[model samples]
Target: MTGGRSPRRAVAAADRTRQPTEVRRRLIVEAAVPLIAERGSSSVGVRDVAGAAGVSVGTVTYHFGSVQEILSEAMVLQIERYYAALSETADRATSAAGALRLLVDALFTEDTDRHWRMWFEYWNAGEHHLDPAFAGGQDRRYESWHRQIRALAERGVADGEFTCADLDGFTTRFAALADGLALQRLRQAPPLTTQDARRHLHRFIETELGPGPHGVGLGPAE
Candidate 1:
């Protein structure tokens, strides 16, 4: 006769033991993202995230130093996911102009509205609270966008698809235009709809690049 733990119990214990530390950290951050996005980082705490993740407070602190760190990491994770989606859209296009069109269209979708709301909260926190943890978050986000825009512009110029006179100036102007339009779109009274935003951006591209292959609007992807 033998006495041992049941097979199901043993398998359950093995599964628990196999969960990696990195996976646990990611789980915690994933749990925290919605909370921070919906309620703002200022309103979320370690206990809330721990409860959401079904992990103990000590586990959260073990992976992330403090509440501020968790919130900041959550913001970074959201932006990283956005970048991945943008990159995927760009990858599907055959030309730089097509890539730009796809990227702009992706920007105005309903799914990204939550991301914009979270980013707005981040900006507000950085501006009003003078919080050191959030100090450069907004700048970094803009910089990432700028880099992508600049790369796309350069590619277009190299391929002879675009006739931008000043690459740097054109990139900066387009980025600013998108940001301003995004803000307007996010307003409660939203002066511009997603279609309007796309039209405005496409028009600007046409004007800058002149009416050619690069200037042709493909319209939003289905």
Candidate 2:
């Protein structure tokens, strides 16, 4: 009221000026993912994440509500990044076939392989306590991959780039095989490099359609 409140008021104002709440919350969630990924769910909680995030427990609970909700939101956020990376992979390939190879490589290509590792780390480790909403994300991921397969197949067939007896079965199998191969590579590597997997995908495409005019969605590595 005199010149400007008091010294305590100044500090309170400074505290109020802390970074945008959402930005801080996102940083916390991001930091929490790798933490929760490495540590089991039971061992980590609101206070733990808040401590890791350098925030108070009250802030985390206010933003994320409960542990289940926090895990759910964290997984959803991480998966979006994962799928976005896949989309980038598709956008960079040279043809539908190259795109397919790139997609496989993109999924399993990183040296650290942190992306998929985080996924399995959370998925395998935390599925039991995961929110029911997470189950829908599984279907959503498959549907998204399914759409990519359909687009690739239709484009390939229309241009006479690839042939298939059954688009549905072909697309389904392609998605399944790609996922299976990605998981296998994650589970066991050194023998199965991304290059080797792409090599095999090329052969499969060639055998399927005689290979000539490739489709256009091919994208570079993500």
The digit string of per-residue lDDT tens for model 1 on 1-222 reads: 112321121123345456799977877788878877767788787877877777777888988877877777787888778878898998898888889888888887777777876777666666664565467767777788888888887777777676667878878899889878878888846577888888888877777764235444333334
For candidate 2, write residues 56-99 as lDDT tens digits: 66777777777766655666677778778788878786666666
Q: Model 2's lDDT to the true fold?
A: 0.62
- Per-model TM-score on C-alpha atoms: 0.78, 0.71
Q: For residue 95, what is the lDDT in candidate 2? A: 63
Worst 10 residues of 1 by lDDT: 1-10
List residue ranges in candidate 1 displaced over 4 A. Answer: 1-18, 125-141, 211-222
Which 10-residue span in candidate 2 carries the lowest summed lDDT?
1-10
Any idea what lDDT model 1 has?
Answer: 0.74
